[model samples]
Target: MKIELRDISISYGKRAVMQSISLTAMPGDVTAIVGPNGCGKTSVLRAIAGLAGYSGQLLFDGRALDRPPKKSNRSLVSYVAQDSAGRSSLTVLEVVLLGRLATLGLRVTEVDKHVVCEVLAELGILHLAQRFLVELSGGQRQLVFIAQALARNPAALLLDEPTSALDIYHQLHVLEVVRRTTQKRGLATVIVLHDLNAAIRYADQVAVLREGHMLACGKPEEIVRPDVVGPVFRVEMVSLPGAGNYPTLVATGPVHGSQGAASPT
Candidate 1:
């Protein structure tokens, strides 16, 4: 799937969130959206997921979508949101089964079970199949939701801060799995990441947004330069010495004369 957003603008009541925001995520590639807090990163994902109404166009492989995707749609784009965890008694297996509900008959079929199991195993969470959602930690629930999304077999995967609750090991593991899956399944993967280094490591392309506007879009290395990072986040991004061929950036401190907090978008 190839997702294209053209001049999208989103607002809530009387408040505008994003304006003329455009992005493209291609199949077999990962596009990571990065910026400071409240920069409309999540809004962009919501618009592309058709969960939020926007002023402009959202296209999937040249086909326009003007409405939220129905649960019955088999080829629906999968979205793993930031606040995905819920207080529910549903076991991990049961929740994942919902992904195949559109194609499921009255009873759960072997194929559906197989697909659920496959995704759980891939996420290394097969042991969590019988665990209730409320019993798991935030990070564990995050992983479960990711498995559920994968079980849907979507052409496009939208992940909003997927690694926010995870530890260093799981963060690296999940992203590696996402990259491998994106390439192997030829799926378009768009992820919102706060960790600049992680975005650079996992994403083939990077899109930087600030105050509801897109500032840059290109290879991760090019987009994360000091010039771009410093102005957007108001940070002094410094490249360390002997950081190998690929530079590693660290925000040493706030830009000398920048403001306190970035205004909400």
Candidate 2:
């Protein structure tokens, strides 16, 4: 499935957090939204997931998304929020089973239970299935939440800082699972990542947002240069050659220094 956001603008009261943003998430690709703290990356994902009100056209699989919270569309797109709220009461297995609720017409069957268990096991959280959400660590809770989202078998996955509270090992683990699952399932995944290196490593396409606008969007190699990154981050970035791999972006100087902007190659 392909997601198209045309001229999307989202506002809170009189303040517009995201303005006239447009982008696409094609199937079997990991598209990342990255920017500074208040750049509205989460708002964009929320709007696309139909959790926030916005003025724009959101199309899924070439069809306009139904505004009334239809089960079809809800099941098609699964959203994993950054905050872990209201989930403390539910056990890991119970939370993951909730993902299949949209598909269960009348009664829960053995197959449904099997699928949920498989997802929990696959995410390496089967041992934590019986534990209460509130009792788990931040990283464990994150994995459970992601497992819940995946149990739905969504066509497009929307995640807001999926690895924010995780340690380095778990961070890489989450990214690896997302990348492998999305590729194997041909699912379109849109994630908001704070870590620039993780975005560069996992994202097939990178979208840079600045002050509520999409400054640039393209392949990682094309869109992640010093010129493109420096202005968005307000930092002096110099790309150093990596050992036979993609170049790395180094913060060479202070952000407020009067360095001449490097022209985009």
Candidate 3:
């Protein structure tokens, strides 16, 4: 499925956050939203999930959607928020199984259980299936939540700061899993990333937003350059060749003459 946002704008009361933000997330590709703090990156995802109010058009497969798709059409999209908090004492398997709740009726079917286990294994969290959510680490819980989202088998997946608290190893592991799953499932995957390098490495397309306004949108290589990234991040980025001829960014210092201001005007 293809998800398109045309001239979308969002506001909280009278304060506008996102203005004329537009992008298309296509199936079998990962679209990364990169920006500075308080830039409404997460708000954009929430609007897409139908959790936030917005104006302009939201189209799915060329058809307009008035709101978040109804429950019956939920298989079309699944969202994973930044907070992985779980107050309940549910087991890992049970938590992941919640992804299938849209299809579940009076009882749990073997098919649901199978899908849960499959997603857990795919995320390398199968061993934690019987474990309780409260007993797991933050990173582990993040993985479980991702597995839960995957279990839904949605055509589009939206993630918010998915690797925030993860160590380097787990960060790569999770992004790799997400990218692989996105490709394998042909899902339209949109992720909000603070790490420019991660977005460059895993995303097929990149959209840069600053203060709720879109700066640019294109292929990763097109948008991850020094010129495009430096101003948005306020860092002087240098590129060095890496594996498969990919460019890696190394920050030398703050942008010239900015004097380390917290934010640019």
Candidate number with greatest lDDT: 3
At residue 132, what lDDT does model 2 achieve? 95
lDDT of 2 by residue, 94-204 (tens): 888888888776877889889999988887889998899888877788878888888988898988998987899989888988898789778899999988778878899
lDDT of 3 at 235: 87
Candidate 3 RMSD to the correct structure: 3.3
lDDT of 3 by residue, 150-173 (tens): 888888899999999888987888
Which ten residues in a row are the worst by lDDT in model 3?
256-265
Model 1 global lDDT (CA atoms, 0 to 1): 0.84
**Candidates 2 and 3: which is better by lDDT?**
3
Query: Alpha carbon lDDT of residue 190, candidate 2?
Result: 98
In candidate 3, residue 146 scores what lDDT?
85
Displacement of residue 39 (Cα, Å) in model 2 is 1.3
Tell me how far candidate 1 lies from the true structure as C-alpha RMSD in angstroms: 3.6
The prediction achieving the highest TM-score against the true structure is 3
Candidate achieving higher lDDT, 1 or 2 = 2
TM-score of each: 0.90, 0.90, 0.92
- lDDT order, best first, reads 3, 2, 1
lDDT of each: 0.84, 0.85, 0.87
Record all residue pairs in model 2 with backbone atoms less than 3 Å apart, i.e. clashing: none
